[model samples]
Target: MEGLQLIATGGALPGRVVTNEDLSQLVDTSDEWITTRTGIRQRHFCAEGETAATLAVSAARQALERSGLQPEQIGCCVCATLSGAYATPSTACLVQKELGLAQDIPVLDVNAACSGFIYGAAVARGLLATRPQDDRRYALVIGCEQLSRLMDMTDRNTCVLFGDGAGAVLFEAVEGAEFAVDLGARGDMAIETPPCGPIRMDGRAVFRFAVDALPRTLHAVLDATHHTLDEVDWVVCHQANSRIIDHCVKKLEADSAKFYKNMDRHGNTSAASIPVALNELAETGRLQPGMRLACIGFGGGLTWGGMLITVKGSAV
Candidate 1:
């Protein structure tokens, strides 16, 4: 299969920044308590009139602009999220309309919970591989979440751990070295949501699952690619918890400096976490040409996956 290079990245967060102290007024929690447990001090929440689709569109536009690619040049649009404005039309469809992308192209959404971004990247790679070689096909992959809408403000356990945001990247098909990809689901509801109820989770179960699944997935991808930890420039895991990342780093016995994290400010944006972290790295000039990144995510649906990608400079 032809390799897909990440040519550009972008992210968008809601205007309202809610700190742990802010939640203290509504719920029985303190900044020190939340920070010690989740390593999250603040998070962004959507205000009136803001929706997942809107954030997705904003992030997508930034990515498109950064890539210098016209909207029509994109061959596919894939959005990863569990929260959408409506269940009928996928978030990708709404993004396509907002971005004025080609009408004939494939546009859809996927739900892998916190692992959704990595899942979306895998889907985009497969889609781009099928396109004609003569055409310069690109896939716009986005991870957007509106978790605040599902939050039970009174439930401190869940409410303090989530935020609203979206992140995006433009993947361009290129003839280059292929990278490894792996995806799996255990069909467990350690984390779940019902038809009308707010988000609920078994915190201990999730923490245990993440710590184990994350390093395993990272090593699986590295082994599949015949690479080693020393060769990877960055390890971007779902920014669900700082503790999970710390545990995975210790267990893997890998260089702690290689792991990237931003949960301290954005908290957990579910599907949006990894991409948001990627965007931050790119904006800060940390992502450079030829750098290898191992992206992993684990969450509800009990899904976990990882993909190895080589960073390519923005499209000319």
Candidate 2:
């Protein structure tokens, strides 16, 4: 059997594109204000008929096709989101129905804000460890959000910073794979939950927390994996801002050309950022066989995580 594998990934967004200029017409913010502060020029928004689950299923379909897997082959479904339309009926269940997954397959939902993808991945990793050989064990891990649903569009501050989208990754149980995972949370840093609506961030505060926490998180994962920065081929971090990306690379002294980024095109997709970027990289043939990639993310709940994986032979 192969070791735990990120076989393939897929991402989907609403057809509607919301440019900063378009947002300016709705709110008091300017294109300059959004660009200067968040490094976001535009983002996608969900259409009238689209919901979080629908976008997630679209993403899952692409991933399943790329991976050559079927709905019944997946033993687990993990959905990561903070903006689901409902509070009950786990989003993963909704995905299971949409994907025609087996009734007995475990369905789980995780809410770690932007860090949700890493959290979902970690859960899928544990699932791989527990399943028996020849069990057809696989997990459909997704990070999705329709943040526009939570945005107080009347308030210019955060209205333009978020959009709606979904991204999915297929994790398969295999053998002979190298893996290192580290996850952390700071309760003191957490924003009050429930009724706070989705997320209301103090940009300055979150910036400080992220800059201080990410390096430590990365170092922890490196130490656990016994790998050095120079050994990494690609560093895929949450695409919140170009400034944050620049700061993290400088602090780690990572090679500029080796970093993978899509912020200029997608802005921030919240939980969907990393996997969306991963799919983009795979589609463009930027990530190849036998490469090592480090995935990191930080977000609300004041959480952060990092996962280091040695890319096995690629099928694409």
What's the TM-score of every candidate structure? 0.97, 0.94
Which 10-residue window of candidate 2 scores lowest in summed lDDT? 189-198
What lDDT tens digits, residue by residue, belong to model 2 across residues 183-279? Answer: 8888754443354364566778878888877778778878877888888888888888778877878987878777777776677777888888888
Off by over 4 Å in 2: 1-3, 189-198, 313-316
> TM-score of predicted model 2?
0.94
**What's model 2's overall lDDT?**
0.80
- Residues 130-154, candidate 1, lDDT per residue (tens digit)? 7666454899999999999888999
Worst 10 residues of 1 by lDDT: 128-137
Q: What CA root-mean-square deviation does each model show from the true structure?
A: 1.3, 2.0
Tell me the TM-score of model 1: 0.97
